[model samples]
Target chain A: MARLTLDALRTILVACAGEDDGVDLSGDILDTTFEDLGYDSLALMESAARIEREFGIALDDDDVNEALTPRLLLDLVNGSEVRAA
Target chain B: MSTQSSTAAGASGRRVVVTGLGVTAPGGIGTEHYWKALLTGENGISELSRFDASRYPSRLAGQIDDFEASDHLPGRLLPQTDVSTRYALVAADWALADAGVGPDAGFEDYDLGVVTSTAQGGFDFTHREFHKLWSQGPEYVSVYESFAWFYAVNTGQISIRNTMRGPSAALVGEQAGGLDAIGHACRTVRRGTRLVLTGGVDSALDPWGYASQLAGGLVSTVADPERAYLPFDAEASGHVPGEGGAVLIVEDADSARERGVERIYGEIAGYAATFDPAPGSGRPPALGRAAELALAQAGLTPADVSVVFADGAGAPDLDRAEAEAIGRLFGPHGVPVTAPKALTGRLCAGGGPTDLVAALLALRDQVIPATGRTARVPDAYRLDLVTGQPREAALSTALVLARGRHGFNSAIVLTTHRP
Candidate 1:
């Protein structure tokens, strides 16, 4: 079981954004879409891909696509499927 | 002005000449293969093999297969550097050799320059590091990871490895960084330098990088491999993403002549880069501006040119716009046009140099290879697209264009040894 902590989120955030200083990391990861968080679609995809490769688990598109908040992405990371609206 | 006068031509500069050529692209890992593949139109675009891209929106990409990194990097350094740096180092070695300036090339004290352009610098490493951090604790995050994938790292890596002390800079342009690298190198040489190793390489093969590109809507994710990267063709759905590398040995005319270098590949005759003043039609035929400026800088006219190396970005809006620009500037029939990149996929910052290599070789061999796989041109695109096999023609002057993914546009004019 992996610990879904802020530090872990920060690293992923920095990598996706292609830099470290933009997002409101001290608060939430899922509070925004890639665009709102200054993360483009490319950066988000990169972040998701690396997460999959690192965790050695097959993350489905819904798992990545549905997670919008930092808490939500972390929740999604742990295998909790996003609740469809 | 109808005249294609690049800023360099108007600046009153010393004649710039190319002394060496090197490449590590989809065409081939090295210059020879890079050129040969383009002539034969080998398709670099294919289904995603680097990662399991089954679920992604687009499965197609231009990936460089069989790139055995160990072949390029010695034992110790392989683990530390990113793939981007590895590609750049290998390309620089090839360019220096092609220029006839090896470790024993005799000028230890001479001032040399090195400039490389890149869009996504080290996505692979950054992606991996992020994964590690997620999988392990903060301690597991390699401290060096901070600098490993940054935008400016590759240029520094090449400069340090080559011991190049003169004029070293990197352009953080979108895709145009590749051709812009050449323009920068040309200007650096004109300002004075013995030789410059310049070009660009980009690898978005990693899943993270791939996703990033896919999300942008820039990549042609079509499942069918053949239809993935048809630039200038009506069937051109979208561009295939991939890696590309090219290195040029730029030098002054007098210096090259002094070394007794044989007939020059082509001179860095003119270069012009302009930003889109506004997004509308007034976006200024910025690319055309780049071309005209380049031609004018070379002291040549469109009538003097035999062929053109297009950007061929493949996005419909950009594609039609580019075609209209070319037909408007060069008049459809007169100047033969070709873009062998359809097979190699667009290399982003690396695309320009890859296209320039084809253009430079065309000047040397006088054959313009056709655009591969582009079976049909859009109705709006009226230019005579070089289709299927190569076009046999004597080329004395050539034009190469590159545009930043965001907005910057550049044009470089090449000419045979100007007597």
Candidate 2:
């Protein structure tokens, strides 16, 4: 049982950017636009795979696309936030 | 046999011309953006920041940035295909849009074809599939995994999505495969197909993909981003691998004339391709021979070309051979050689189409940018290397050259359309 930090989330975001720079996964969880940080559908799936392996979490591509962001990623890792959709 | 003065390839059918161009490049994702970035000499190469690239020898590459598959492909098709194929679909859609074709348009009704090429089709998908099969058992693998990794997936997907049934081909991208694909598409018109969607797509950013290049010793492993891949520079180590994939709108010249498509970006005037055999096996005469034959095929002389889009493998020995080949053709002087991918890294199958795009752009602008990362041309080269900033002149024709890493060298001639 390990804890996630802001630094770890940043690393994940940057790594995802390299693999699929087209996805918009950067900003806020609540109001962030889908096109802002480049997470298109395929990118969402690819990122979900990478996240599941890296954080030991099983996230569906649809869920990731719906709530993918730095703040949201941190909240999800800490179990502070629940999947809305 | 009433044909008088026609060859097999030349007399294939109606002449194909480029109507539109769309690209998802590392420097810029789309046409206007990428063309602007290219003209400004932006450096898209950097360390493989996507994964744990720390373990690999060649950590540097021209990685694509800010390009999401969702931005280019439909939502329903998302879960069905691999990243590479997704890239192909998106790029194809963009190209189609650029050409003024609708997404659900009846491309099948028009004699359209799709030909895409790549070296390792879907290494990313295969690598992940293998990992899953090992860890979670065989049942965990997606059914689409097998199709994703195949070489012809891009062409098949593009053809199906567009309903283009003319002729579907997935070239293995032997360097000349991109040129050959376009050439093959052009030939289809003679058999009655009016249009062809021909290009290549490759995204080798995964671990195994990086490792495969490591085995080849063709990548530059230097840590410094600016100094890593200096093609034609004496201090060059090796090339920086990049994400390469693009789609070109090619069609018959007569059809284009009939439709009254005004902007004749460029024409596939003449093409030549050959294999050099193995390296140190006494330099096969195929590339030079191909170049000469390409000139003859285009009904052109070496003097007709205003600039040369070099293969620019970034390998010292190969670069020298390419320079020698160009020198022999155009007389050891200023034919103006340019390699735009030096900044973006080699995209493998993506290389030729992107290069083709650059050649078309160069013809339109009448200026070719210098091969990025090179100020002083290598000692052995005698050809005029366009370096540092873009050069402008009255460009009429361009000779694009490519030599695949797997023993294929191809040259394509493109002529500018004035009227």
Best by DockQ: 2
Q: Write the per-residue lDDT of candidate 1 for residues B1-419, one digit (tens) a residue.
A: 23434435345446677778777776478877877887887877777787787888888777777678767765333544678777877888788878887666655534688888888878888888889889885545554576678766777777766777788788867777887888888878777776777888887778899888877777775778788888888777788887867888888777778877875788777887887776666545577877877777776778887888888887788888888779878786557777788888878888888888889898888888888788788766877778888889888888888888667888888877764
**For each candidate, what's the DockQ?**
0.02, 0.04
The DockQ assigned to candidate 2 is 0.04
Candidate 2 docking quality: incorrect, acceptable, medium or high: incorrect
Looking at model 1 chain B, which ten-residue stretch has the lowest summed lDDT?
A: B1-10
Q: Model 2, stretches more than 4 Å misplaced?
A: A1-85, B1-9, B103-110, B278-283
TM-scores of the candidates in the order shown: 0.80, 0.80
For model 2, what share of native contacts is present? 0.00
Error of 2 at B110 (Å): 5.8
Span of ten consecutive residues with least summed lDDT in model 1 chain A: A16-25
Candidate 1, residue B223: Cα displacement in angstroms equals: 1.1
Candidates in order: C-alpha RMSD to true structure: 12.5, 9.2
